[model samples]
Target: MSFLRRLTQAFAPPPRAGLDRHLAMAVLLLEIAAADFSRSEEELGLIRKQLLTGLQLDASSAEALLSRALDRSDAAISMHEFVALLNEELDAAGKRELLSWLWQVALADGRLAPHEEGRIRQLADLLFIPHADFVQTRLAAGA
Candidate 1:
C-alpha cells in the first residue's frame, strides 16, 4: 500500500452501520423538522429522544450518531439516500413501522407543516409504501 494510504487506514475509524442508520433517520427527521421553515431546539431534542427511546439507542451512541447526522443532512442531495438505506436494511413491514416513526417526528412540533407532510409522502412513495398504509401509519403515530 502507498505510505499515506496505509497511514490513513491505520488511523481511520471503524465502520459504523448503526450510526449510519441513525444518521439516515436524522436526515429524514431534519427534513421534516425544517418543514415549518424553522428548526427549533425543541424539535432537535425530540428527534434525539425519538432516536434514543423509540429506536432504542444508547445515550453516547445516539449523540455520536447525531453528529454524523448533521454532516449527512448538509451533504444530502435527495431523500433517496436516506430511504435507500432503510430499504436495504428493512423489509416492507419494517418500512411501514418506520413510516409511523417518521410521522411522529413530523407531528411532534404539534402541527404538520405542508412541506413536512410532503416530504413524508415523498419518502413513502420512494420506499414503495402504499398511500393507505402511509396514512394509517401517520394517524397511528399521531400525525
Candidate 2:
C-alpha cells in the first residue's frame, strides 16, 4: 500500500461500506415526504408502512430504521450519495417502484406541492427513470 494511504488508514477509521440500501430508500422516501416543508401524519404513516410491509421489518425495527434515516437525511450534504448507492443496488424496475413510493408520499397530504413534485422529478432524473415512467408513477399514486 502507498505510504500516505497506510498512514490515513491507520489514523482514520475505515469509511462505512456505504449507506445501506434499505436506509437509503427510507431516507429518500422521508425526503420526498418532507419536501413540502411539512411531513404530515399521512405521509409519515405511508413511509412507516413501506418499511413495515415492504421490508417485513417488525414495528420496533421499522421505527428504529426510520429514526436512523431521519438522522442521516438531516446530516446529508446531497441526495447523490443515497441515489448512487441505490442505483448500484437497485435494478431499473426497483428504481421505478421507488419512484412510485415517492409519489405516494408526496400526495399523501392530498395535495402535490410544487416543491414536492420538483423533488421527485430531480430524483427521477438521478435514478434515470424516463419521463414517461415518472408520469406513470405519479398517475398511479393519484389513482
- For candidate 1, write residues 52-108 as lDDT tens digits: 987799999888877888777777676665777777787888788778877877777
Model 2 residue 119 distance off true place after TM-score fit, in angstroms: 0.4
TM-score of 2: 0.87
Worst 10 residues of 2 by lDDT: 12-21
* Residue 125's lDDT in candidate 1: 93
Per-residue lDDT tens digits for candidate 2, residues 1-143, read 99999898899843545469899999999999889998899999999999999878999999999999999888887887788889899998999989989998998889999999999999999989999999898888883
* Clashing residue pairs in candidate 1 (N, C-alpha, C atoms within 3 angstroms): none
TM-score versus the correct structure, for each prediction? 0.79, 0.87
What is the RMSD, in Å, between candidate 2 and the native fold over all Cα?
3.1
Best of the candidates, lDDT: 2
At residue 124, what lDDT does model 1 achieve? 89
